[model samples]
Every structure is written in structure tokens, then in C-alpha cells.
Target: MKKINEITEILGDDTSYYLDHVSKKIPKERLQIPGPESVDNFRESDRSPQVLKNLAQLYNHGNLGGTGYINILPIDQGIEHSAAFSFYKNQDYFDPENIVKLAVEAGCNGVASTFGALALHSRKYAHKIPFVVKINHNELLTYPNKYDQISYGTVKEAWNLGATAIGATIYFGSKQSNRQIQEIAEAFEEAHQLGMATILWCYTRNSEFKTDSDDYHSAADLTGQANHIGVTIKADIIKQKLPTNNFGFREVDFAKYDEEMYESLTTDHPIDLCRLQVANCYMGKIGLINSGGGSKGESDYKEAVRTAIINKRAGGSGLIMGRKAFQRPLKEGVDILESVQSVYLNDKITVA
Candidate 1:
């Protein structure tokens, strides 16, 4: 696996852009950043003892294990992005066993996948590594292809399948967001009651979130608010896209926002923009794990390392990367996963 120096070399000239800047707002001190004792420190608090146990299991796995950093392999694309689109290039991934095998071989904290995938091999792999069952997905089969999430299984079913946690997506700002929030909120409560942790794939979907100049779907200010709502529903961890730009609220002129939010709090720096994302995760009490977006070929390793660097410096948790690790041959995919873990393992890559 590569260290920070090797990772920085992969980034080339852009290395200084992420490493040299100091954040202006929400300095890392105020955040309850991840550590080995993260679970013990909050053992007797809002979470049940059983819930804390499972949450700790997540914190203590993978290549980044026991450091309060996590690296998860999420492969629900067979449902969300369609089986053919996700697995056409790599036929090995079509088998659910290969899914679990990849996560284990790649040293992921856990594997998050659909009910069918996990249930098929739960007994064999559940105890070998943590399982994060994704209970909901947006099927593209709808005629007009509406963008909305629906449950594929129940919380009890996931718990029975030996999942340490349950993952779900809420398309915040969508026409059906209200329903999605209510459904996932109740499901999370059930999962917590059953001694399971919960992760929210907090994303924004809506045409209004887009402007000719910028798309607010991945905007820091807007996605930040979406994260606030996710934590409000008591998500133990949040999976979000790395912020692409700021001033989403000001640009859209839809919701209430402060000029200071853009001016005094955040700058154009990637770390600053992502810090706003962490701030909205209940000030890091709820871990903020950024998503590894679609693979762009050739530069996949560099881009994965870059996202990990930005996320770590921003005082966030680790990553839940998928395509970057599974789109190519299994060995190359494992290399990508291990490289991201190396970033968190390097103590020199401190929070900016």
C-alpha cells in the first residue's frame, strides 16, 4: 500500500492545493474527531450498550481498524446502477461471494450491499467481517426513471442477517424526501433498538438544486444541511459526496442562508468546503464518510487518493468507496482500496 508521500506524488501539481491550505472556519479542535476510544467515551450516552458494541465493531475493522477511522466497501450498484452497468466489465463480481471476498481481501471495515447479496452468504462471512446491509435503493426500471429511494427489506430482516449496521439513502430536497425521511427515521430507530448502527447516504436530488453556473446537489452549504437532517434522524454515520462548490443557498435563492455562511465561514478551499460538511454532522459526533464517486479511468487511483486526502484533512471520517475499487480487475481494485487506507494510516496526514 502507498503512504502519504507516494499518494501525494499521484496527485502531481495539485498536492499543494489540498495540503498547504489552513481552514478558516470551524477549526478541527471543536470537532469530536475519531479515535480508538470513540465508543467507550460515549458508551453510556444516547446509544444503547448493544448499539455501542456494534458501532465499535465498525470502528475496529479493516486496514484502518482501531484508529476510529473506517473504510467500507459498498456494492449495491447491482440494484441502484443496474447489474449490467455495474458488473459488465468484471464478471467475478456477479457472484455475491466475490463481493464479500473483495471486501475482506481489500481490508474493508465492512461490506454494504443489498439484501439478496448479504443474505445469500451471511452465515459464511458475517462473523469474518462486519456487514452493513443497505435496506433501500432507487431502481432505474421506472418508465420515466424517477429519482426516489424505496425500501427493499426491513430492519429486522437486516438484523437477522447478521448486519452490524443498516445503510439507507435519503434523497433530500426531492418530491418524495418527506416520505423517505420518515421511513428511514423509523427504520433507524428500530435498528438502534435492535443493537445495530445506522448509516445514511445523505444526498440531495431536485432540479431546483441546479443552476446554469453550478449544481447544488453536491454543494457544501446545501449538502451540509442535508447532513444536518440526517443526523437529526440520528444517523450513526453519514455517507456524502465530497463538496464540489459553495454558495449553493445563495445561488439558488430558495432556502434561508446567511451571507456569512459563504463569506466568513467557508472559502474556496476544498478542506474548508468539506469542513462545513463535517460541522453539519453534529460537529463530528456522527462520523462523516465521503462517497467514492464514479471511476474516470487511468486516474482512478489518483482521484481516490485525492478524495481521501481532502476528507481526512477536513476532520471527517474515512470513505465508502465502490466503483473505484470494483470497476477494474480485482487486483487493481484492491490496490485502490489499500491506497486510500494508507492515507488514514499515515499519522503525518493530520487534520488541516
Candidate 2:
């Protein structure tokens, strides 16, 4: 029934309505920092206007673990692996400014990058987005150790760099774990003095600490146990990798398998299982967030989000991902970050 001219207009011109259609569907967001309206209002006030007061309250001036959820950005891979290996393959990622831009664009609560990166990039966006400088780093190219060492950058330096928090990784089961624990304790005290928070990357890694059998690295039971340790040490937030169903505990109490506790703990699926574990861990005071692992296809990323949705539903802080986020093209990586924010804030993973 269409007219010939209409058909010709649709087919011959190559005109497109796709972009316009997509633009209209986008939800209104906190897209621009100090958005246009806020900037206009700011010019009228000297000390503190009502809008600035509201902005401070919304920005979580003093609250980090309340109902106001947290989404952290971690770009520590450059120190975990080698800079050449971690940043060279995707060379644009080597630039510190791009890292900050990606985090802000993705709508994250805060970004966690190494001290060096933050120092280089803070001048531009420190006032715009919150920053967390990772204090310890073990380089693959240097002296090899079983666990990462506390390296450059101090809590004082992070404060100087305008960081909102300081993060460190402590191998829970390593022989040096106690020393790392001591380091964390010291770091916690210092960060608190500066009115900043502390985040810990806790993992059960040595032969002794991991010998618990039921809980160990990558095991829900162990990860949960590590979460408790992080709380005891006063970490404001904690990070762990996704857990597998593999029971690593040494005990063989088969009779207790079908108990209510066990049944309540078990999840409907792997993603749900991890969620259950994090929920179980929430009994402690500290907040728990899962780390984003290696990069994978979009489907795999979505599944990771499905797992995170389970965590958020049951009670989780948010995500602190590295390679899974910044390793790809900047725009695509940001898209993935937005997907995670969608999961955390909206409790839905169906968003593209």
C-alpha cells in the first residue's frame, strides 16, 4: 500500500532513523559532572547553597557503606602483570587521563588505580570523580615472590593526590600474610586519620591458610571467611574473585550435607551460588564486592553481571574490576562498565 516515492525514499537515499530512535530511548542520567543546571546555580552562592548541600549529601560526603551503593574502578593490572603486557597491547589504556574518563563515563562511584596513575591524572578529574590509589604492587618483571609486595605510594600521598580511599591486597594464607595483616592494620589507621576509607583485596593463598579445606581461594566458604577477616581488620570495603562450587574444605562430614544451613547456602546456579556466598558473608560489618576477572565475550560479561545481580539482591556493595574492564577498547570497556552499573543500581542485567 506504500507509495512509490515513499518506497524510493526509504530504499535509495540510505537515510537512517536508527541513531535518532536510539537517542530518544536513553534514560536521563547524571551524565555531566556538576551538570549544566548545577553549574548555573553554583555561580549564585558563595559558601553553601541548598543545591550544593544536596549535592554533598548525594555525593556521600561521609557515608561509604550505607544504602547509597558503591561501584569501584580498579586499574591495577599494570602492576599485577608487566606494564608492557598489561597496557601495551591496548596502548591507549596506558594514558592515565583516558582511565579517568572511562570511569566517569561509566557512572562508577569511584575509581581505583595505582598511585602513579592517579598522580598523573588527578589534576584533571579529581574534583569530578572520586579516586582510590592502590598502595601495594608486586611487579612480575622484578624480584619474584609468591605474593604481591606493598610498594610505592603512601596513604599520605593518596590524600595529597585527592584520593577518597586507599586500597591494598593481602594474601590471607601466605606465610607473609601476618606481615601483610600488620601492614593493612597500619594502613587502615593512617587512612582513617585522613578521613579516607580503606579497601582490601583479600584472598586465601598459602598452603597453611588455605588448608581450612572448606574455604580457600575461589571457594565460597573460604572467600566468605576472608570477608570476615577483612571486616575484623576494619576494611571499609572488600573485594574477591567469583567463587566456584568446588568445596575446598578438608573435612569429610557427609552426614551434614542436607542440613538447612547447607541448603540455604547452596544456590540455584553458579551465579546464584556466588551471590548466596556473599550474602552469607554480609553477617560481618564490612561490605563485599566481587572482582571482574579476565576479559571474555559479551555473553560471558553478561553472565558475570547476572552473578553480580544475585549478589546485589542478597546484599553486596558492588564490583571492582580490572582487566575485565579496561583491557579492551576504551568505549567498549566503558560499555561493559555501564552494564555493571546497570546491574548494581537497577538490579537488572537485561540492559545492553
Candidate 3:
């Protein structure tokens, strides 16, 4: 694939590590990876028929459709990062219709955003592309902002807006985590009963997650556990950040884990670390989709392609990237989203 070589050129010296085959700590053969037949796997589970139908609509649209890999555009930052700050790069996004239009033009499988974003334009665009309404957000307007996630709207509200899925975030390690978990679990239950799918932004948040030398929030072991927890809550899809390193527990001298977790089950390799994320999703019974972090200007396209390659090779699902696409001009944003979708559509790129 030409895109593979493009990734090599973009990564430069880091190319070999990103391209290496992952150790068999978690065999790709045993993983239920994304594909045209992936929707069949859900029928065997407890998901309702209507849930299955909505999932089919999600998987069978846009450029990456039927391949089972999903490319979603999440734009809920209005509340999370504030409307003015998030839309500063491109004020066009201030109008919710532009957000949905961008996803459609870019051939994305779905568009995810705040409740009001999808609700206001529901009648016009909901049927054209699957809508994933983020059910909760932590408004930055709070004085001395907190890491907590609170419901911005109800799951039924999202369903009434014609959304196919409901999304929520749980800061898995924060002090208020238990309450967030209970809230999201209850919301997901209501969503499923309402015939909507569920996706969780499984993230770790703790002051101790960082050190002067390394940030352990993206640690393989830690994020992997978050994926397990997300699946336990019956999240139909788990959205996580790509693993950057391992040894979060050992280095932080915190959390509960075993030595073999690092000794035999994992290494410092990016793909292996990501494989651990897939492994924790009950060996791929639940899909693991990585988030595209904030944009990096000229490097956004390359980084987006790089992450898609890593996620696909690691036997995980695709990406739900935002800022990378939304922060730029509309055409450039479409280019960024399509660049990542190219990786998933190319048959030449196989699972590691």
C-alpha cells in the first residue's frame, strides 16, 4: 500500500517500531477483528434486534463501510473545551450543520457531537449518517475546572433526536469514577432498551498518572484495564487513546497489577501495547476504537494515518478522530478523515 510507505516516510526513524509485527502475547488469529461479517457477531450477544439494526447502519455507511472498521467524527468539545476556544480555529464549526456536513462530505461512518448539535439538525441529517450523541460532558465553565464527567442530557433525548448511538466518558481512576460509572451504566441500559447502541470514552485520570519523565495515562496496562471495565458495562464499542508505553503501575508505584503483566504479557512496543487493549475487550468480543487526539497542524494527516495503521494492525477497530479534521478548513478536514479511512479500506494492510 502506498499509504504504508507514506507512514514510513512520515514516522522516519520511528517507522520500524510502528510497523513491526506484534509479539503473540495476544494472537490476531484469536481476535474477532472488524470486517463485512462483523455485525453477525453481535447477534449472538444480548443486543436487541433494533440495536443490531442501528449498528448495521453505523457499519454500512461511508468510505469504510462493510469493512466493519468505523471512522467517526466526534465534535463535543464545545462544552468540554468551551465553544469559543474549540471553534476558534474554524468558526464554521460554530454552526452545528457544518460539523455534520463535514462528516458526510468526508465519507465518515458516523458523526458524534454534543446533544444540541445533533438535536437541532436531527431532521435534516440524522438519516443520512448515524448520529452518536455524547451523553455527558464536563463544562470548562466550572470554576477551577474538574476532571469529572456529568450528564449533559438524557439517553432518551438522544434517541428522540434520531441518534443511532449514545456516547459517554468515564474518568476511570478519578475519585468520582464510581458515580460516573453508575451514571453511564444506567444511561447505557436505558439506551439499549430504547434500541440505541452504546460507546464509552474509556480514559484514565489521576494526578499520579504523570511523572517528570513519562506520562502513564496512556500506559498499556492501565488503559487496557479501562477497556475491560468499559466492556463490562456493556459498551457496544470502547473508545480509547492509543497506548504510548507500559509500566504505569510499576513507575507510579500505584494500582493493582502483576509483574508478569509486563514481563511476559507485554513489552514497550506500541502494537503489543495496543494488542493488550484488544485483549482486554474480552479478546475482541467488544470493539476497541482509538480516539484521535488534538490536531498537530501540518502533522495531522500523517499522525491520523499513523494511528489508523497501528489500530488496524493491532487487531482493534478504527478511529473516532476529531480536532484533526474539524480544526482545519473544511477541505483539509475532509482530507484528514479520508487519509485515515484509506488505511482501513486498503486490503494490502493486514493485521499484525
Q: Pick by TM-score: which candidate is best?
A: 1
Better TM-score candidate (1, 2): 1
Per-candidate alpha-carbon RMSD to the true structure: 1.0, 11.6, 1.6
- Clashes (backbone N, CA, C under 3 Å), per candidate, total 0, 6, 0
So what's the TM-score on candidate 1?
0.98
Candidate 1 lDDT tens digits, 1-29: 88667978998999888787788678888
lDDT of 3 by residue, 84-109 (tens): 98999999999999999999999999
Judged by lDDT relative to the true structure, which candidate is superior, 1 or 2? 1
TM per model? 0.98, 0.72, 0.96
lDDT (C-alpha, whole model) for all candidates: 0.91, 0.60, 0.89
Model 2, range 187-234, lDDT digits (tens) per residue?
877876676767888777755434444444676656666777786776
Q: After superposition, which runs of candidate 2 have C-alpha atoms over 4 Å from their true positions?
A: 1-67, 143-145, 207-216, 251-272, 275-285, 298-300, 347-352
Ranking by TM-score: 1, 3, 2
Q: Can you list the residue pairs that collide in candidate 1? A: none
**Residue 45's lDDT in candidate 1:** 63
